[model samples]
Each structure stands twice: as C-alpha cells, then as structure tokens.
Target: MTELQSTAFVSEDKFAVAQVALYILAVLQVVAAVMLATGGAPIPFPQQATAMQRLSGTVNAVVMVLAFAVVYCLLARCLRRPTKLVWRIALGTFLTNFGMVVLTMVAQPGPSPVLTGCLCFAGIVSVLRGCKSVKAYSHS
Candidate 1:
C-alpha cells in the first residue's frame, strides 16, 4: 500500500473499537425495535394496565429505540473519517449510554442491564483511549 493509505489505515485502527461499539449499539437498538413491534419485548406495566396503556408504552418504546438506532448508525458512519466534533459527540453518546445503564441497573437490578452497562463502559474506555489518535487525525 502507498504510505498515505497505510497511515490512514493505522489511524482507522485507533478508532475501530469505538466504531464497532457504535455498530453493535445500533444493531441492538434495531433488535429492541423489532421485539417491541412483535410484542415480545419485556415492558413494565402498571398493575391494572389497560390495552391502551400497553399499546402506548410499546409505541413509545419502539419510537425511541428506532431513533437511537438511527443516531448510532449515523455516528458509526461519521467515524469513517472522524472529526473533532465527531469524536466529542461519540464520547458524549457513550457517556450518556453509560449513565442510562447505571440508572437502569439501579432501578431494575438485572443481569441483562448489567451486561448492557458493561458494553457502554467499554465503549467509553475505547473512545477515551483513542483520543490522541483522533486529535492527530483531525489536525492532519
């Protein structure tokens, strides 16, 4: 490979972990959306939940999951040629996900939520570790 291309590849490797995490998050969001649509997702309901309440909860969850999926996909695409702003945004997203996971674990205390929280923590660490490389690439 040409020197320039090789350099680009090396830079890409720096951010690859974050990119993979974003892709995984996007895919998980999509899966959640599908599960919600098919009524297979576990959604909390009040003791006397009416049909309308169940429908409303499912629709809202589906919409939120789909929106987040779109955002994750877009962020992953931006990582192909990450800018400073993209890096900050990605870090912010990872932090936000981690925060939410913490809250979920506190409220629900389940294995599933703990696993999700671990993934979010890993994403945050990956992005932090690649900070210098992303800054260099942005400057270049």
Candidate 2:
C-alpha cells in the first residue's frame, strides 16, 4: 500500500485518542461547573448575602463555566480532523490549566487541589499523546 494509505489507518487511531481526551476534559468541566454553581470557592459569597449579591455571584460563575465550555467545544470541533490548530489549542489550554492547578496546589495544600492537579496532569499527557498521534499521521 502507498504511504497515504498507511497513514489513513494511523490517523484514525489518533483521532480516536483525541476524541477520548476531549471527552475527559468535558467531564472535568462539567464537574467544575457543578461545583461553581453550588458555590465553589472561586465564586464565594457571604453566607447571609443579599439577593442581588447571590444573583451576581451566580452570573459570574455561569459566565466562567461557559467560557471554558466554549473553548472545549472549539477544541472538539478541531478534532474532526487532525490539523495543527487542534494541536495548538490542546497544548495551550491543557498546559495553562496544568500550571494554574499546580499553583493552586502549592497555595492551598489540600486534598482537592491534589486531585485536581492529578487530573490536570493527565489531561496534559493525553493532549500531547493525541497531538503527537495527529502529527505522525499528518507527516505520513
């Protein structure tokens, strides 16, 4: 078989890996959203806060969650096929989040932070694997 034909087989596997990674990120985002909606520390408000205060907090939390969701969706779309853009986006988002999670772990020293850091690390590895697969398939 020709090189292109051989690459087609490899590319499909890479695409599947990328899709699995995206699904994992999606699940993580959903958990984060639920936490935020139920008063994650990032969106903290006073226990006896006024209605307006609560409303504003909710709005802010929703906006934050949606922003991440949109980015994840965009990355998913890029995974429709192996393009450099997918690699770039996956690298940027996961790496940035991993760094931030590390910072949070250092600052907080809590179990949740440890868990989140682990998850973030997994995400970084998975994205790299997927992108590397894409690169290999592309060059074939």
Candidate 3:
C-alpha cells in the first residue's frame, strides 16, 4: 500500500470494542423483552396491573430490543468498512441513547442509569476519535 493509503486506513482494532459493546446492549434488550413477556412479574406490580399497563410495557420492551438490534447491525457495518456513513450511524445511535439515559436519570434517578449513560458517552467519544483516522479511498 502507498504511504497515503497506509495513513488513511482506519484500524479495525479500535472499533472492535465498540462492536462488542453494541452486542452487550442488544443482548440486554433481548433479555429484558423476554423476561417481561414471559412473566411481567420481574417488576413488582402492587396488587395487580391493568391489561393496558402490561401490554404497554411488553410493547416497549420489544421496541427497545428491535432498536438495539438495528444499532448493532450498524456497528457491525462500521467494523467492516469504517466509512463515514457507518461512523455517522454510530454517532447518531449513541447520541440518542445518551439523551435517553440523561432523560431517564433526570426523571427518575438511578445508579444503573447513570452508569449506562457514562458508558454511552464514552463510546461516542471513542467512535468520533476513531472516525478521524479514516478517509474513504479514492482510486485515480
């Protein structure tokens, strides 16, 4: 490879951890959905829960799982190409996720939520920095 090409090539090793992180989030979402759908008993529901509340929670869980799956796919794509588009997708995903975490913490404070938000913020910085090292190849 030419020196220019060598310098432009973004190391995949940098983003490998990001892909693994995405997988962890996806797995968590799937597990949460499964647990909620299976029993809805995981969380205490006072005397009883209305059908609407149960349905709403189940649907929400399913949506979260689906969203995470999409983000995971983007991360995989980024690992493969490290292109600008993939980096944008990763940035957008983490930005929204970080926003949600902040909102959740503000509305209802929790240790776990805080930790998750910090982790997501870190992921965003990691990806943005990694993206700086990549440039789409141009064949002349």
Candidate 4:
C-alpha cells in the first residue's frame, strides 16, 4: 500500500464532507427501509396510500435495504481501508442516486431532478478529489 493508504491523518480530515454525506445517506437508507418494512408512507409522502402503492412500497423497501448494504460496506471499510474504498463507494452511491433522480424526475415530476443530479455529481466529485488529495498529501 502507498503511504497515504497507510495513514489516518489525511483520510479523516479530507473525508469530512464525504463522511457527512455518507451519514445523511445512511439515515435516508434506514428511514426508507423502515418505512418500506412498515408498509407506510415515508417522509416524502403524506398519505396512507393504496394497495398498489403499498405493494410498490414493499418492493422499494427491499431495494432500499439492499442499498443500505452499501452504507454498511463503507462503514466496514472505514475500519480498515478508507483511501481505497471511499471513492468507489461514493461513485456507486452517486450512480444509483443519479438513476433514481432521473426516474423520479421523468416519472413523477414533482421534485427537482436537476438539483438532485447536480448535488449527487458534486458529492461524487468531492469524494474523488478528497481521495486523490489524501493520496497526494501522504506522498508529499
């Protein structure tokens, strides 16, 4: 492993923004999983919803649980390897969120797809830059 990969000083400070984003993402995942599991409307929605909607909700809950696995994986990696894993996980989250944003935009039209996409894109870039910076910082 490179020097940065072996160091914590660079990873912790540089990854603060990404860490906050990951925390928010993790909470969102947990809420989504619970909402789906309970067969109720999540925070984004207000009503109890129809049978069809509930069925879809159940399906979404399953997917959300799986997505939350990524959060778990990142957490696990933080214990052993931050430099190598953070950027990859961020990229994965960004791609998955990006697709959801597009679907939400085209299918629902009530939310801001552009804004969501832009934010996700920015988060992904931040994470990548942070990772690169950490690596470079260690070398320097």
TM-scores for candidates 1 onward, in order: 0.78, 0.66, 0.67, 0.56
> What's the lDDT for all of these models?
0.85, 0.70, 0.69, 0.63
lDDT measured at residue 29 in model 3 versus the true structure, 0 to 100: 65
Ranked candidates (lDDT, high to low): 1, 2, 3, 4
User: What stretches of model 1 exceed 4 Å from their correct place?
Assistant: 1-12, 42-57
Off by over 4 Å in 4: 1-12, 41-81, 111-119, 137-140
lDDT of 4 by residue, 1-140 (tens): 58877576555566555555556556656765776677554434447777787677577766868577576546534623355555566667777887898889888775446765665676676666676665765467
lDDT of 4 at 116: 58
Residues 38-131, candidate 3: write the lDDT tens digits. Answer: 8742645556889788678667767776777776765865655577767777778778889999899989998867866876787787777666
Residues 60-125, candidate 1: write the lDDT tens digits.
Answer: 999999999999989988877778898899999999888988888889899877767777777888
Q: Could you tell me which residue pairs clash in candidate 2?
A: none
Instruction: Name the best candidate (by TM-score).
Output: 1
CA deviation > 4 Å runs, candidate 2: 1-11, 15-18, 40-42, 46-50, 130-140
- Model 1 lowest lDDT segment of ten: 10-19
TM-score of 1: 0.78
Off by over 4 Å in 3: 1-12, 39-64, 136-140
Order of the predicted models by TM-score, top scorer first: 1, 3, 2, 4
